[model samples]
Target: MWKLNPRALKYLNEVARFGSLRKVAAHLNVDVSAISRQLAQLEEELGTAVGMRSGQGFVLTQVGEELVALFRQQKASEAAALSRIEALQSLKRGRVSIAVGEGFIADLISAPLQAFMARYPGIQISVEMAGANEATRLVKEDRVDLALVYAPSPDAELYSHVVTRQPLELITPPGHPLTRLAPLSIRQISGYPLALIDQQFGMGQLVSLVEELEHIRFEPQLRTNSVAVLKNFVLSGMGVTFMPGLTVHSEIKQGRIACVPVPHPVLAGASAHIVSHKGRELTVSAEALINHLHDGMLFFN
Candidate 1:
């Protein structure tokens, strides 16, 4: 069995994160030569070159990528162990990192996050807005403390809880012809050019639902990954879009955009979930944020 030194692993992890050994050494307040020596020792132990000098910086080799995975797994385990011990002490000031989708940011988390900040003034909060795939990737990579994503994974290594259930609705300009209809079906919506989120977005899941209910293929006049752009297009009367109810609530109330319930029952069942990596421990701030989220979710129900 190969023995891994924690210090060397730390050095490697920092190097990988910063993309420069000199920067890693500077952050750690160590000599650059010391970092170089540690990297050499690590490569010797692994019996392969983990990284190579590129101009003024270093780039990871394939072996380095594998080492990074191993190091991250070990680091996560150690962090979990420390967190358990710390939890027994008390929940105090700590940092929490979260990744979420843009739609959820506008609809669900923004207000609660602001309130959380006000309550836990000592706790540091970091948030990253990304697509569902990127959100999941961040959680899996241990880059984020928690992720709120649109889709759920069946993987046993991921723990998921439904934070909120948002019904999908078709939105158009307030006085659009479709607004007069009692309820609009997917087939009827397909008759017009649709503005949709690109396939990478969670909204792309609706495509299958649309296909199941309607025989006609959709021809999207505009496709964007940005929730803001999608809403702008819909509000401008350029084209109609299928979006979560929370996303356009204010617009609907203001009579700028009209939301019609999807006639297909299956389309209404889409939900957003809060997910975390399995076996990972939550920091003090992370746990508090999760509790706040649970409380906020009650409003959706």
Candidate 2:
């Protein structure tokens, strides 16, 4: 008998990741003693210590490292198998999971993804709103079949199926004094009350990089990870924010918000991407939906 327990493997991976049994227990909403007992049984079965605690945190043994790698591959393969089985339905039935950055949600629901749902009502779709890092992580972990990200960090295990230029712009309430400047400079933007996204998001990261390169900084009145909050900050005439125009396209069209170009070369060249695991084959439904998003969304267009 193989004597392998997927549940034990799952607990081991979480312990390795979090580096503490108590922390993993809290995260998994289980008792710490339960995790310990499971791990003890695992060690008994394998007849080896998989990990050890140190001053820093838990460190996996060489054997444990290899086992984790194998476990990850097994999970990725299982995801692929599910995708293949979903393909057997010919798009009439299947579930497609997508992780999207909060900044892209406005555009995603309005046209691109909604159109896909209409076209294939039989297909089940799950959309998770996450920050840039979380979105990529979800794809990398095979928890999501696809991710829509802006200014994604390069990853060897991730592939970009669609990349479109989505320049970061200065957004303000309609007729705000800054709108007159059209393409504004960072210094000029800083002169106003600034409400910026935190470093967890792509726009915030880009702005921080520019500040570092230019040896300057802005004292933002507010900082957050929520796109809705940023938009509300601008719409309330409280302050200005930096975001892609497409993120607030409907508001701009309604003449409630004004999106002015930011002339910085880095901001001007920013792009959004459709990302997926490198070697995983997407189902027919997943593939078709990606195509729909590319063609139907203003974010891509």
Candidate 3:
């Protein structure tokens, strides 16, 4: 039978988290040699190498990935147990980390994050802004408790909740001729100068798919990975862009931009989702925040 020590598990999981033994050692307030010793012992006992040293740093083996996942489950169980104990004493304390797209911060995440923090001052929260695919990756890697992003293709490792479907919208500077139109089509919009988000992002992928299906190509006047920069391009009257309403709800309300829903058959099918690791029990802090998100997303619509 293989026996695991708590300290060894912590060290291994931290190494996976930071991708550095030195960083893990510093975080755990232990000597660097201690981490190495325990890691060596762990692999020796398990009859497999958890990680191998490389020129750049430590890289987890296939076994190491499985072990790390098990460790995350263990940590989640510990958190759930602690939540039970805390409830008996009327105390709540834990950290909740989220991975979300940058566009979600202003409209979808901000209010709920603030409310959750205010309600549970003892909880610690961290948010990482990333692209939709990056957000999904973060959740899968156990780097974050939850993710808010455009619907990623189904993955068995993830569970999606709090879903919302919104058509992609054509965004333009105030008083652009397209604004006067009731609804817009990809073919119609492609005729104008275009500013496009990069394909690494979900929005970009959606637009690219439509272009390919329609047998048309958009020669963008500006192309960028940054949503803020793309918005700026539109703001400066550089070119029209396509984005979901949730991304630019504030701007539309303030009359700084105009958003007309895309009439493309596929654009109407896009959606947003809140996601977490499948089959993992959430910590009290994470559960609370997810509840807040579910409620607050009503306004995001």
Which lDDT tens digits does candidate 1 get at residues 43-133? 8888899899998588999998888778887777677666556566554456778897888776555577778777767668888988987
Tens digit per residue, CA lDDT, model 2, 102-203:
888878887677778888888899999888888898887677989999998778989999999999999899988988885577888878999888787888
Superposed Cα RMSD, model 1:
4.5
Clash list (residue pairs), candidate 2:
none
lDDT of 3 by residue, 1-301 (tens): 7889878888888898888899888888989999999999999999989999998789999998888888989877787788767666544677888998876777655577777777788888898988988888888777788998874667899998677886777889988888777666666787788898877788888888898899989989888988998788888888789888768878888988888877778788888888998977787668777888887764234
> Which residue pairs clash within candidate 1?
none
Report the poorest 10 consecutive residues by lDDT, candidate 1.
292-301
Off by over 4 Å in 1: 7-70, 81-90, 108-110, 152-156, 212-215, 297-301
Q: Which has the higher TM-score value, candidate number 2 or candidate number 3?
A: 2
Quality of model 1 by C-alpha lDDT: 0.77
Candidate 2 shows a clash count of 0
Superposed Cα deviation of residue 191, candidate 1 (Å): 1.7
